[model samples]
Target: MSAYTTRQDLPGSLPAAASSALRLGALASDERFEVTVRVRPRAAPPDLAASAATLALKPAQQQQLSREEYAAAFGADPADLAKVADFARHFGLVVLDSSSARRSVFLSGTADQFAAAFGTQIEQVEHAGGVGRAVAAPLSVPSEVGDIVEGVFGLSDAPVARPHLQQLPEAQAAAGASFTPPQLAKLYNFPTGVDGSGQCIAIIELGGGFRTTDISNYFKGLHLPVPKVKSISVDGGKNHPTTANSADGEVMLDIEVAAGVAPKALICVYFAPNTDKGFLDAITAALHDKVNQPSVISISWGAAEKFWTPQALSSYDAAFQSAATLGVTVCCAAGDAGSGDENPDQGQPDGLAHVDFPAASPHVLACGGTRLKANGSSIASETVWNDDPLRSASGGGVSDFFDLPAYQNGAGVPASANPGGRVGRGVPDVAGDADPNTGYQVLVDGRRLVFGGTSAVAPLWAGLVALMNQKLGHHVGFLNPLLYGAAVGSGATHDITVGDIGAYQAGAGWDACTGWGSPNGAKLLQVLGS
Candidate 1:
């Protein structure tokens, strides 16, 4: 076999039409660019899907393994990484850092050096966010190095996912009876006695920051313990809050909700830039963080599947798969828009139903939204979230990229949609209270704000998973198989049999709008504990 292989074709997300030259004027040859080389795993567990399914039915203890054990079983080969580093040095690039598992090799060099090394143009591209630099074409490397480099990220610094948090206006009439986090937990029958002690919930953020004082004051008012929060920066991103945007709403809401539900659980927030490199790096850092060793991670940011390249999707999904092997549960918000998931301003269609990525990825739990009404702690009624005229609702639909996983084989996932004959993965796997009319109250940068989106649902489920891990005495890694299995027919979840989000309607068993429905905490704990 030839020692080299060409890089895979770039996704449609980075179209040829995006080739307008950046306005930065003549590029300096000495200007350096940082890039991450993703190395392919030496060997993938051939039966990984089956193994995850089996483990989902068994206790967490049965499949749990230490970081060292996981790395030995599935990380990239050391020899392959050495070849990549040598190639970087051969082209006068500096090898900044290489992960212990050799999965990610970070390198830096001038645009001249990179252009010479990869045989690609180094230029900035114009995007909706602003002009950012990127490789104008597919990168090619020496045969020896190309054989192992799965993909090269950070080459094109395009804007990443947007926070799914939606701020509701102050004047909107309070529809459902408002409830604090604790009160909401009670209404859902969350297990008592386990306050998520001894567990760390990792929260991934692309932008925004959280203030300690706000977290302290809010929790104090509720008479709950102020959860310990830690910040870990990735890819040069920081925890800076600016007055220009409401992005901070996402940062604070994630922490407040998870902490409120699991007061004693340590919360570690990983802050990164809003770019493809930053997003993927943040997730990889969180998944492999030995210091935090979070058993559960909550991500409230995502873009529609159509916006991601095939290469980007595969790389990101691989990270989630690795998390499953390490016994970590990841919860991602489906999206805030209805089935279309379109951004008219971005030239995307308004009528086509598209699901969000990460959420749409079968490995992570795709959490949708719902409007819940309660009469003094007893559930009054709940329905799929659809606040029409306003044009906001929970995101649910079949994916155009991924196929249905084995776990969803017979859970009533449909095989057709508005873009008929397109059979793919159905999101979400579960849902939570996310309607702005029935939204969670959060304090962002000192302002009391009401926000709703599938965003809040991710952290809500993360807290529940943290509590379950604490109660069960182990982590519950990948949840879909179990969710589609034993946890389905059992009394663990509430089936939302009302309303429609757009292309899909809520029904008895499973539907795109609500998945297997929202969590019924107490019953869920009992079933999973056994």
Candidate 2:
């Protein structure tokens, strides 16, 4: 007894790699789990295009909406939520939770129940991340609710992304030129007299966790007060710190680097599973959390555009759009694997250049990497971070998914170096020192290790944004449009004019490798403040 006699395909619901995965067996019928259903927004979002233009030209004139205001205006429709909940009841699935602000409904049921509800076969599949569950075919929903449903996630729990982090070997780490976060802040000339006292930085972590003892000891070593840090569990993910070789490195690095720069800024970490559903849920939760009300968010995890589903990409981008309207800035790591975001040891498996997602999303502040040499407190040399083109390097290139945005018009962004040579949005909107040979010294699992990658760069930029927000007396939401315009010629950045990253090179003003170069904090603050 279903609500509708017919069914329709859920757009962008199938993972690109699903068909290629090694078939293990049918999923046990009695196995139980949860899935998230994304409902369409109540109405079309506000004119973000016009808002972006204004934010670039006259940030002071831009109007920001609070969390409550946004929900009331753009959240899901009550009637639509009721229809979805009724549909779930018809299929014997329990409605675990629902949120208008996030436009999501959490449903729990057995594998057989989900298979019946979505009109798909659940099966065990072997992917790079090991055995997991996935739908053997495209997901479908009751025709009555098809148009109202944006996506159905957690049907497939394959690993979605890897942490964009690189740690040097103990021997090399001990011998390399590494600097503490404070030293880098000084070199970059961050604005003085502001410690981000009133701002909250939201950090998204897919795996791993941080220890209180580690946070205390690390800050004590730096001679700085331990910033208040809190954790929010998403989809059952929590702060479970294991060993140094695990994702704890990424978790600790993000916290230490961001806190080290903005000592008094409150840090809220949202831990989620490394699945598409978990990732998206974590982002929405952070963006809509009224308690924390983060002014900026830092994401150090992502994969190439090719690995993601069309629905997941659009959904995540939509969440970021909501972030812009709420006057929140999101900083994302570009990638550590150069233009080819896959296994570097394999040498471009498909031979096509790729850019990491979330970073490639035009709405985010895409942070790239650099190698630096300092003389005293001033930088002697800075270049595109490329230690091995076939391995570690700053990921940069034209995006294959997103179109070229208006803000990059005068920046001379080049087309993708791949065969088709299609023009698209360029990446690494900003950069920072990320070479393991010239990395940041961080404490992970009680071990002091040197880490580098675009991962460090995300939190580094997030920390700077906190300081900027504190100084400007407002949130510097959606900073890309401004960065490409006024901040370009105003000495707000260091403009790296040397080196390359395999498929692309760096020179003059904006290039794929370093995107207008690293920060000159004080100058950037002045430009934004004006």
Candidate 3:
């Protein structure tokens, strides 16, 4: 299960940045609450050193695992999971669901049962945009269960993640010509044949909805086949669209981008709440889903790493690790707020360098933003996306949380410039066009809208990865090792050398702003496919 919490050093209260002391109201004790118990991974991936060694070898020499095989090798111990479930039942919590592969136990009970079981109080707290219920105090479990439970999430109903997609205003949209995703794909030299048939792409969203008419109309306009699009709800979240929420734009952008590039691929959209619990559960569910079995998953929601709880961070990282063990490639947006990644609610920029989570997680491919200038079907000039200081910019920086992974050890990496004197993981392992000035056009809610952000890059990369899988006739899981290895210098990517993202600037090879750079799709397929 999870680490047994015994030491006093374990965090007692939520991070000041994550929880609020101000109570707006209180939740009724009779209300039902759904909480998740995240468990520890069965074991660390066989040996990071050995794994890298294998990656260095030819594709034929690489060891690959099917989902079932991977679960057998890396999933949580069943007995440990049972122990957690037993504890939940002891506290009068109903066992709603459990997944051994994801090492998670889902429980539901009245607010009174939850409060009594976890030794924490729940209260309605004031939050940005609206008021929500959340855990108001430190959570502590029995010594036995506390040791095994990695994180007790879903107790709080706080909204944490922000959708990375930003729609262009009417003025901005009318200012320039917007390119459809396929048009952009062609300019980037994405292969013409191999339309991602027989491949599945999973798009994760915190909130948003897309209409079938919008998607069908979009593909019809491009004179391409309309790929299958399906929605799966998680943690009571729905594909609900509202005029007040711009999240629907994010949902549509992700789907259209991936589907446009890989027109024949099946697109599965996972809609979850914007809270940490919902985000974590969605990822875990997507990672462990055996039916849809997406070859690649794209995420366009995230918050600054510092805003997440320790358990939240570890649990999410563990999920990414599991994706690596399985033959699944995950792509996440680096954020749109440059290096500062400041909280908008904080009044002004903190002037501190911060990185977005899920993107910063070592196991996933973090996609940054770029401004692309293309003439007809050829790329003109691409630079790091940096708009205005007060507005959006490509997010990239040394992480305040994760350490540098072994794959990131070589050239194009900088040493720690922070006070901690620790070399943390650098972001934007790969990048794509995300500037609204050169954004992707999509049909959302029956309206044609242009949007941009690192959000577009995640699904764009995921679609490219799906096409690569189709062309190679196999899944290329966990791209970092390959992207950083022998194929790096083999013309697989277009290195961006201009522009900056707040505190960090772009340069040759790798930089915090745009990493190795944008894709040269066909060449990448050839190099990585080999």
Candidate 4:
């Protein structure tokens, strides 16, 4: 891969077209420049076909594209230009000057002209979000599926499970488990001598600002310490006023999970509004986060590939690399969407990045989700969490972009999943509680909801990093090398033993879904302590 195109960074949530370029005019000259642009989705009306729980589109607005031709538009990332170059070269599509985070960039030439030349519709290239969301449809819940699974597993069992992770698990209440810091800390115990008192843990959230009152209430309710949480806003996005959004819900879960697992650590949240610009800007700010000097940053947001560009990846590559030099460990969600982002169309490399972007970046750690069943003192059955195509799934799969990093080779993970087979870089390096049906309990704007997704895993891992820093005498910058080759018997990590997240089934060893399984907090501390 050439330097201009060899970027292996995690693709971000920003639309993919935002980074493209082109050879403008009838005469291809250096004067013909490229500009970043976006292909926004037209509003789709509410229908039974909706897969997303968040706002749905208005309807089949395909005709909306014919009039999309524009005489002017501007201000996109240089990446948008690359998209133009890449797409045009691949399909002879023209490049347009107009750009945006939502609207797809036009190729400037008339749609009919492009159709005449390429034999393909040039006006609207489908944004894969809807298509990707459809892949999990196979996992949809059978109205009685949760009951059947729970019944067979026996809900009366100690520390049982509910259909969702974030919802109030009757098992948690029945087992007398409370979401207190110390009690939960055991789940992330640093090796015997570890402590995180001096380390910092930074959290990246899109919305759902935590209030001082909520902190007091949460801690007082749990009889735990009030974590030191500092709020930082990026791209000038302000603290959200509180609302319901998967983006914000995921953010809240990240903070609470990290805090619960590593209470004594300093927690700083970098907030960005729920937009691609704010999301990208927030991460850039986190990479250079001052005052906090956080050795670990946790992220839990993601979108499909094709939605991002190499330039975006290159920009983030710098940050991830910087964190590494600074000894910071970057953790991200592997997306809640599953494998190949499922496309019914055909097997074309998803024009998009896979799973989670930043997480897919070779510079960071990607975390996947799992559904777990625990008894009084032991984790009974654990499985890779996929939203029963019927329910949805935790994201996991190989990247069409990022190259395989050195840390990816040893883990029994086959080299084939790396289709486009040229690149390397595996994902969900480490994971923990992310089964929304069996997820953690929480309070957001005083509203209680059950939640789980790869979102919960990122921060949970960050909290573990804080404790590792406490024990190792410094931050455990990138944990992959350490976790990947460790002996299977090393009690430090638990190998997930059941269930399946999409195509990957949970087994005795590492699988694509749950990377070393969930942590054996107590033993992990013992091993890391050594």
Candidate 5:
């Protein structure tokens, strides 16, 4: 379902800045040729079939690794092997597995390397049937360029399992959620005096089509000011709606939430096909939008950590930085998988470590998941929220490949104590409601689906940031360095003190489950307001 375009003329590196002319996502100034690589699936064994998390090969497969026949050929485990496996698994490659071998792997390095890995000859690389160039950065933060940032703190006090979102009575439910109580409402010192009139937020999506009719209906129900929304395109062209998922719902929720919090802001939605090429192109196009140029951009779609190459990661960091330069804050989903995505690429679950990306990249703010306990209509509490194990949970952990950026020098994130010696990056700097069961209700075309995922967290937080921007009349560009410093102890954030996300247990102060807990809307306004 994806294509890889090969570039023979260019080096095996992506540009710190883009030069492609053919735009797919919307930001392309040049038309670039891409080779298309069709994504296909392979079979895996029974026990190993759905279980994508087996660390060493399965007992039966030991011969495959031990035999000099295979080991010698593949090398002492290809250096890139770890990277490739990590990348593939992160992208749900395993889910595509049949009932035989393992999943097919997609290699992003040199052709010879891919051919060796897949045991195939290099035909033309496939290009994502896309139309936009992937933008790298919006602001250039040379100093923070090389380091991995710190993120995600846990809250152990919110309800882990709760009631159904669909069955909730329409009369009791309000257009949007509100926080009132001890922690969340307290720290969420929302700057009541703030207004987002001069600000704009950009939403990037694939596969979901949202209609103006739905928008009118939604706001009318909420009784909020009808937002000024503009649609842009890349390959797909102009105003349109694609498909729906937690990611799409989350994007819409954030837009509405931000508008609700800061009514004066304008919203721009950039819809692209949800392919790699389309994803990249959409972002590029969104960046180029001169009219409604977003002061903030929120992306909720991505694969596992290693799916992207260093060049790709760098490109994204650069893109976010570019946005930072423009006073834009980029927020991303940490992932629905737990500490490690249980063999995300494979269908069967395993207890291994996996992280979601571009969230893992030091540049963007990684958003996590949480559950809120409320009475009548007010948020009673918010805590680290997640589904049962091997199911889905907020993604939080340390990175293996990246070194801690200097900005992380004193942040509480410890040097990862894992076998992988690299300084790790803590995911999900901040979190919001991502529990699918207790998910948000949204409008797509005409119907409403209550969906949730880490996908929802990113945009929700981004919208909050927009509201904050409206309040301060200033953008909080690249907030990691500031948020992670000592803000955890500050009342700026509500300490979600309940519940647990499968793997990690939430507790008193910052835990891995719910990072620094959920926001206290009114309080957040006050803190940011000041």
Candidate 6:
């Protein structure tokens, strides 16, 4: 018999993929696993309405809290933690670790123990990718702790996201123009005299790894000092570099672009597994890291919103809100798939428009893609990046998950191009060069390569944010509100008015294809500095 006689459903605990996956059979009773339980904040978080008002203010006027202060005010409640521990003990689970700042309690147990504790069965499942474990039913918690537990993760270890990166095909790798990060910075007129000194930029990688030798050689070729890079493991994930064809491209791309543009800033890379639990844990670890204290975070990994669980979406969004209050900026790749956002390589298109999450999260600076033809130091032509509509393009569309934010109210955000035309938040809040034809020249696993995608754009903006912070002597936290407000018409961004990505078209001002267009870094600095 279960320890608790009565249980309540844990809202949003079911995996979205579980519905379609073919269930094989129950897991072995003694199959061991570890899970993370996300709990509610000790106190209610700051009001969104008020936070919007505050974020709209100039950088100096914002009342940002330090990590210590934020933890004290909004971290997990001790009582809530104790209750969860008691519940875990009753079900024969061992408490692994807990963090007040991250509001997470880690536990280790067998399949049978977890099944009894959460009132759900773990089963071997067959999906398109391969066989894995997943929950077949909605998870439930004891009635006493139902409200305190926000999400239960790691019951299913299916892959959650893909790296938003595209390597130029070998056949055409030499056919188009590619610029090094420094050259693009010059073309974009990034602010000079600041090397992101006194700032730390955090990067999150779900897989692959980076070699110091590659980093040293890459920067040496560029004649830039190698930025200090450190890898922090999350959830047992490590810096295990493999071949160039693997996720190494993403890890290398993120590091090279960010460090290339902000050579003096400390780069802290948080490596984790590719599951939803690993993704969320990597993010929270980077945000709450007091030692490194990243002023901005760059995430080049994400999937379409449809692939995520509702609990995962809400939990990740809530973490971004914490970033805003702590004065840390988060830059996420808007995705490589176009408005449809379906994985063409895996199967046929779903024939419906979709947007990517983390980028779709209202709090993040969603970085989009553009194709640029530069005339020496100046941009001759720039437009929406859409080499292949179904397979590769700058991802943009109205989000089905999040409502329109106040800052985007006047940006002429359109309804979802899909049926029912639901109104929601638009993606790709900003843009950068991201076409494989005009991609960034990078070093991956000691091999020179050209990589593109909104993947590169996230780090591009992250490096720019670090430079901006160094120049302004403050973190330009939560830039979307200000970008839509004071920075409009300020010549801070070059408005791309050409090209289209299937469901959306590029326009003079804010459009779904490339919101407010690509950056003019010097002007952006002046706008934020003021």
Model 1 regions lying over 4 Å from their true place: 1-28, 46-56, 173-176, 345-350, 418-420
The estimated TM-scores of all candidates read 0.93, 0.97, 0.94, 0.64, 0.64, 0.97
Over 4 Å off, model 2: 17-20, 47-52, 345-348
Which of 1 and 4 is the better model by TM-score?
A: 1
Candidate 6: regions farther than 4 A off: 1-3, 16-20, 47-52, 127-130
lDDT of 6 by residue, 1-530 (tens): 23567899988886453355788999888999899999999987663323447436786677788999999999999889989999999999999999999999999999999999999989998864478788878899998898999998899888888899999986677777999999999999999999999999999998999999999999999999988999999999999999999999999999999999999999999999888889999999999999999999999988888889999999999999899888899999998988887768955667889898889998899999999999999999999999888788999999998888887878899888988998888998999999999998988887888999999999999999999999898889878888888899999999999988889988888999999999999999898887
- Candidate 5 lDDT over 94-165, as tens digits, reads 322111011112223333332222223322211332222232222111111112111000000111111111
- RMSD to truth, every model: 2.8, 1.6, 2.7, 17.3, 17.3, 1.7
> Any residue pairs clashing in model 1, and if so which?
4-143
For each candidate in the order shown, give its overall lDDT on alpha carbons.
0.81, 0.90, 0.81, 0.52, 0.50, 0.90
Q: Give the TM-score of candidate 3.
A: 0.94
Clashing pairs in 2: none
- CA lDDT, candidate 3, residue 124: 76
How many Å off is the CA of 16 in candidate 5?
21
Write down the worst ten-residue block by lDDT for model 5: 150-159
For candidate 2, lDDT tens digit of each residue in 1-530? 44477999987777554345688999999999999999999987764533336435645445788999999989999888888998988988999999999999999999999999999999999875688898887789898898899988899898888888899999998888999998999999999999989999999999999999999999999999999999999999999999999999999999999999999999999999999899999999999999999999999999889889888988998899899888899999999888887765533356678899889988899999999999999999999999987579999999988888778877798979988898898998999999989999999998999999999999999999999899999988888888887787899999998899889999999999999999999999999888
lDDT of 1 by residue, 68-134 (tens): 7767877878877788888888788999988745388889998888777777777755765787776
Q: Clashes in candidate 6: how many?
A: 0
